[model samples]
Target: MPSPEPKLIAGNANRQLAQAIGRRMSMHRGMQIGLVDARVERFNDQEIFVEVYENVRGEDMFIVQSTSNPANDNLMELLIIADALRRSSAARITAVIPYFGYARQDRRTKARTPISSKLVANMMVSAGIERVLTMDLHAAQIQGFFDIPVDNLYASPVFALDILHNFKGAMDEVAIVSPDVGGVARARELAQRISAPLSIVDKRREKAGEVSEMTVIGEVTGKKVIIVDDICDTAGTLCKAAEVLMDAGATEVHAYITHGVLSGPACDRITKSKLKSLVITDSIQPTAEVKACENIRIVPIAPMLTQAILNIWNGTSVSSLFDTATLEPIYEPLYPGLAFE
Candidate 1:
């Protein structure tokens, strides 16, 4: 017996990505869901308004919105849509956020500061989101911020497969490099799967858009280096790290980032950098400027997400879809009341 399809909804942020995901899911189970034009014009006092054209009563709803460009607006749109679905008697509402925003600000660096990621998580919970499905969050610990079931999908398997297919014979000579020490865990996982050596680029950032110097922590000399990261905002660190790797006698330097939130001259910098290639996921919609870059390549993850969604919907194990080398499957116990609190 086939399971009932979940309703798909899309907001203004990254409509094309949402449609792609919808099409992938629809190939198995049909859906009548469509994107509603969520464009809003500011009033004199500055208030936002939204309208949804589809009926979602008694249905399992998934609001697809990526907090990418105009992150605040996209976040608000998602929140409003969730609230609307809750009010419309939806059985379940899952926030399908491919690229979660404000994830970098998970902690307070200064006194009297707020943890923005926690606040966003709280907002989603308050907005009546039953679950969250996001990919390659900037900080993995951000999952703890949400009270709902949060699934953090990995884009590495997708990229690793693409790399193996497109850049064949280079795996032996290649070394997966982490853009920073913080991303060592992620890079190591990718490297292990690809059967390549691992390296790290130790970089110091004085401020936003500026990196002082970079040091290679492993033997990358004469090796093809592939830097992995969750997000690339300014491209400053990535380009600088590529420069350092090249100067350290690397044969070539490439980068594979999950989310290309390439704001403000990021594409331009990558185009002018020493990076051999820059591969990023379509988690965030690529702008015209990003599309114009010759070195940029987008690897699709829609098929992966669609399969996971189907597995979950059919009461099958979704974790079995990926090759998790070192990362353990963090699942909650079903029998929680059996003596374990």
Candidate 2:
């Protein structure tokens, strides 16, 4: 028997990305996947309501929602949307969460704090989510919290292609630096991809989102340093590491981060900092100030995401989708219609 067509239902969070994914999928696969009509809106009292206009019975559904800034609201919307699809007899429901909220709370450091990542996983499972697709989760171990299959996509292939193209002439002088110890593996992987040196920023945080002092652990002096990280919330770590790298006689500094949760003076800090540019993926929707920043460049994840969806639907290995060692043409243009600032 022929399988039903796949559909993408988007929540308010990162709608642009969702739309881009839908369009890319259709364009590349001859209308293989489509954007479904749905209303995810707020009531008069600010309560959420979702109504799927399409008959999704026995359909393969992918719900695109980013549990970003308005964490609670976005999370609720995804859960409700999944519940609606499950109730409508969808064959399968995969939650595509580009930016997972509560990911930072994977483990409890304090006495009373909860393992919110696990809690979110439980909520999604209870809401009838059969699978999860997310990108560069705050902690890799967050995947273990879920009972269902989880695909934690990497931004390295996306970042690597961009770096190879942008820094075409300076690969010999380029160095990939991790902003902190936690990101060493990510930075190291990129360094290996582009055949560049690796560096790490040794820093101590007084509290979350605050960096006190930093020291460089590798030979970054006279090198064009590229700091790699998963999330850039306040832009504090990137800015601080850039400053410390400059103080260490580094030639130039740039950052390629996966999720740009640029909130609260992040734009201002990036503008005033010494870093040449901060590249980020559109995992989360960019705000007005984030779009207005002169030094911030956004690389769309839609093409890779479209390919992943195709791979998943075709029963191909999604794990083999992201690779940059050969530096082959991953995608001709990262984002077709989007302009990079």
Best by TM-score: 2
Any runs in candidate 2 off by more than 4 Å, and if so which?
A: 1-3, 207-209, 325-330, 334-341
Which regions of candidate 1 are displaced past 4 Å? 1-3, 30-46, 206-209, 324-341
- Show the colliding residue pairs in model 2: none
Alpha-carbon lDDT, every model: 0.80, 0.87
- Give me candidate 2's TM-score against the actual structure: 0.95
lDDT of 2 by residue, 1-341 (tens): 22455689999998999988988877876755667888999999989999999888888889999999899999999999999999999999999998999998999898998999999999999999999988999899999999999999899977888887787767799999998898888889888878889989999979875777898999987899999999998887789889999999899999999999998989999999999999999999999899999999999888777777777777788887567532234466552332222
Error of 2 at 275 (Å): 0.9
TM-score (C-alpha) between model 1 and the true structure: 0.89
Candidate 1, residues 233-272, lDDT tens digits: the string is 8898899899999999999998999999999989889999
Candidate 1: lDDT over CA atoms?
Answer: 0.80
